[model samples]
Target: MRPTVHDIAAAAGVSLATVDRVLNQRPGVRHVTREKVEAAIRELGYIRDVAAANLAKGRTYSLVFILPASDNSFMYGLNAEIRQAILRSPAERTDIRTIEVPAFDPAALVSVLEELSREKPCGIAMVATDAPEVRAIVDRLVRAGFPIVTLVSDLTGSLRHHYAGVDNIAAGRTAARLLGRFLGPRKGEIAVLAGSMLVRDHRERLEGFTSVMAEEFPDLTILPVLEGRDDPEIAHMLVADALSRNAGIIGVYSLGAGNRGLIRALKEKAVDRTLTVIAHELTAHTRAALLDHTIDAILNQDAGHEVRSAVRVLKAKADGLAVIEAQERIRLDIFLKDNLP
Candidate 1:
């Protein structure tokens, strides 16, 4: 049989109340008594059931999610998933709330993080901006005992507890391979569309895409990245202008949001030209584009899965328990027209 609190108390020559205080790290137990109880726990291999104890105490974990205020299908999908998680909050013993900050705004994100540090929720998850200031604030908050997780977009170098998102570099590399294979023996320029270089995910994707293209497909020249800020109108204007100006452009790789604009641009500008296009996210626009052969392939990370993983990791961190890494690992899902689900 497993050792219980009673066994710990008996082995430590302490009362039940004393053992409880020590186990919960609550005040009132003397240092010596705490040490004795800890020693007994180590000796007897006593494991505290954190879930049962929290349930008995009626403990509710308050968690905050910080998202970018980007007007795009991917962001909309992510918000919908968060809303679904909110609907299930009662059963999960979580109080989940979301805060939106302007996309690519480092100062605004830092201010929000500072405020959240003061509010001191049980855990925090954010689609990080990937700026030095943001990373500094995150590191400080983690040092101050906040269980922080990076969602969707991760911080490059920080003390964030976990990242509940796909490997963006791998996703980008996959996009390159798909586009390269689709464009078979062609020797023309490839245009890249992005939200912004400020976010780590976009930067990493661009890095992977460029490295693979340079190494394997030396015939394909990559044009300068068109930064659309993840806005449909901006992406449309930029992509349309790029295609109009560059007649040699043979492929499009959109490793970011704003596929709506990319699709519209491709339809309007590349009417006579046969441009192989690959994009991210499987939204309504992208799905239709894929069916119509406007897009050759799509690489996606499930918004619902990412949100759920964030909540699970946060809850486990709040309860002082270890999370199964394999369970929390979010995989990249590649979708073509035939594989759409």
Candidate 2:
């Protein structure tokens, strides 16, 4: 027999009202009491019938996901996940929509956020670039009672309710460890190609990579950053120029989008198989390049996981329910030619 909320309350040694508050994540419950109630729920295997709860509350959440419009593998993956969510919305009883703006443009993102504020969706998920104006816009949305979750990249010091992405700092450290070990004590120059410094993900990745390199692998020198803006043409041109200037470059770390340009530049320089290339995202371009020995490894964040996490957190927030942190955790996936999945 399924346990009732009353049973859960009895098991947790709390009053029925306290149990209700914990389950609904209402104000006035202490952290310790909340934890105790949650532990009891887990131990009892109590599952809240979300559909019944929604019906009882007369809930219909309208959710909007704002993404960057870029011709890159990462953006493509994110778009695919959003489409999947739209297809799955009927079962969850959600009205989900996606909006795309110009990539690497904080003003454009801010404008979209402001527009959404007027329209006032029940929940919002966005990939925020690090800018004071952008943060301010998110703050305004929060004050208006919209539950906001940051996807992929984060906006620090904002009222964002949750972050649905991997530990980027750990991802960076992992990348450095992989690159350093792969190179095997060779003293050589490494180039870092990023989408944009203005984005939090890029900056965090750079920080993590540099920290690992400084602490563990001081033999390799990282060259000045090349901003690709997630554009194939720009990435290709910049990489080619860098290669021409630095003949001893032995490794390349692509922490941004747009592998097309990187592939082209490597092929043009005839260094496709010579240089050890590590990049992010696993798309057709990166997959093919990996098979062809152009790219060595891929550090990827599953777009599906990010999108699903965002939806779950937003829905919970809208319902005034607590999120399951373990269920919503975003994991970093490391892919090589051997294990694609």
Candidate 3:
């Protein structure tokens, strides 16, 4: 039989109410009494029943997750994950709400954060932009005791408690390595497409790609980065322009959303499978592109995994409990055409 709160109270010679107060860290318990209750807890190895405690408290953590309002398949996938989380809210006792802000707008993100701060949700999850004002807003939310988690893109010097995303640097490095090897020591220029330099994920991916290309694939020249803003039309135009200008382009690395444009550009150039293409995110577009030979390899971070991790971490932090770090660690999922999932 597992030990209960009553067992802990009795062992400590403390009242049930006192034990509850001590366990919850509620006010009014003296230091000595709290110490005694804690000692008893240690002696008996008493583990609090999280489910029961939550049920007794009747606490439903209200959580807000801010996502980019982009029409890209990646954002769609992330929104789907958020909807799935909402469906599971009753069982988890979480009131999860999603807010979509304009993509690549630091001011819009900051405004959303400010508004959410006023509403005072138990937790906030944001796909952060690299802006000082945005980081300051997140810091303010953290100081106000809100558990903040950064999803997809992280804000540097923010008070975010956790980051539910993959190591983009590693993902970039992997992409470069794969593309470099796949191109077979070719001496040609590679075009790099990014959503925006303001996004940490994009920046990290670019950094990693640059590092690997410089060290191992010095023969391959990297063209200037094209900011597509994760827009299909923008990506298409930029890629088409680059292809028209750079005939020696043998590889392309897209470290952002909006592969639609990339696909169109490649198809137009009649080099869909000829150039070694590496991209991020495993959406339907990219998946199909990979199958049809538009993209060679994909380095992905599961949007579902990231959303769920943020929720779990937020709930744990809201309840003043420790999170399972290993469980919450996000992994980079590499996909080839043969191993599509």
Give the number of the best model, judged by lDDT.
1
Would you list the rank order by TM-score, best first? Answer: 3, 1, 2
lDDT of each: 0.92, 0.89, 0.90
The per-residue C-alpha lDDT of model 1 at residue 301 equals: 93
Of the two candidates 2 and 3, the one with more favorable TM-score, higher being better, is 3
What lDDT tens digits, residue by residue, belong to model 3 across residues 1-341? 77999999999999999999998789999999999999999999999888888788888999999988877788788899999999999998999999989977999999998888789999999888778888887888898899999998887677789999999899889988998999986799999999988777888999999999999999999999999989999999999999988788999999998888988898898454368899888877888999988889988998899999999999999877899999999999989999987
Q: Candidate 1: lDDT of 256?
A: 85
TM-score, candidate number 3? 0.93
lDDT of 1 by residue, 1-341 (tens): 98999999999999999999998789998888899999999999999877688789898889999998986788889999999999999998989999999988999999999999889999999999878899999999989989999999888689999999989899888888888888899999999999888768898999989989998999899999999988889999999999999999999999888888899999999989999999989999999999999998888999999999999999888777899999899999988899999
TM-score of 1: 0.93
RMSD of 2: 5.5
Q: Count the backbone clashes (under 3 Å) in each candidate.
A: 0, 0, 0
Give the 10-residue window scoring lowest on summed lDDT in candidate 1.
Answer: 48-57
RMSD of 3: 1.9
Q: Model 1 lDDT vs. the true structure?
A: 0.92
In model 2, the Cα lDDT at residue 112 comes to 93
What ranking of all candidate models by lDDT puts the best one first?
A: 1, 3, 2
TM-scores of the candidates are 0.93, 0.82, 0.93
